[model samples]
Target: MLTLTHRDMLTLKHRDMLAFGHRDMLAFGHMAMLTLTHRDMLTLTQRDMLAFGHMAMLTLRHLDMLTLTHRDMLAFGHMDMLTRTGTC
Candidate 1:
């Protein structure tokens, strides 16, 4: 089995974010609003992780502004994940 360390995961997540273009973001939103496949779930997980990590750092610096966006992402990410996984 292959395993990824934290640093490796970060690198992969960053790469994924870069690979996801503006059009892809729109598609992701559409997918989130509807249904996601196993592959989409994996992609979303990576994207959300990258966003969450970024938001965490920003939260430390700009608490008021970034916090709201951070919370929104968490809420939306969780809702989407939960609904898709039947865990909600």
Candidate 2:
């Protein structure tokens, strides 16, 4: 079982934030502020969730997944519909 204290959670968040590029610095500051304010009340699950979301976002950004245009959105929507209908 992995147990994390508030300080550990903050450290992890900061480290992950810094792993990205300069474009994410603003978001890093925002996350740091939010974590500092809510550190005392944060549960391990909540921290894990936040970290997971950040990791996903970072992965998407790194893969240029956030550069989707309107056409890409439409295509993705179509794909989602197909998957939902078990047709893809």
Candidate 3:
């Protein structure tokens, strides 16, 4: 049996978010809405974690679309991970 850490799970979630392109935000939004609407099926903590991950992904995507500085992106990326893991 293999066990995954929370960091590993979050990494996979981030990878899924990165799999989409800028042109796919509309589709992503629709999918996210569907997922979020059914979030009642998840535990409160799970829902909160998912919401945080989605927000991080959206913010990163928005900044990318704006052609933000590499340093800014790096900072956001670091902050997102730390924030999500409650280490910030």
The Cα RMSD in angstroms, rounded to one decimal, for candidate 2 relative to the true structure is 15.6
Residue-wise lDDT of candidate 1 within 39-69, one digit each (tens)?
Answer: 2222222223222221121111111111111
Model 1 clash tally? 0
For 11-44, candidate 3 gives per-residue lDDT tens digits of 2222222222222222121112212221122212
RMSD of each: 15.6, 15.6, 14.5
In model 3, which runs have C-alpha deviations exceeding 4 angstroms? 1-52, 55-65, 74-88
What C-alpha lDDT does candidate 1 achieve relative to the native structure? Answer: 0.23
Ranked by TM-score from best down, the candidates are 1, 2, 3
- Point out the higher-scoring one by TM-score: 1 or 3: 1
Q: Quick one: ranking by lDDT, best first?
A: 3, 1, 2
User: Where does candidate 1 stray beyond 4 Å?
Assistant: 1-19, 22-37, 41-50, 54-88
Q: At residue 53, what lDDT does model 2 achieve?
A: 18
TM-score for each model: 0.16, 0.16, 0.15
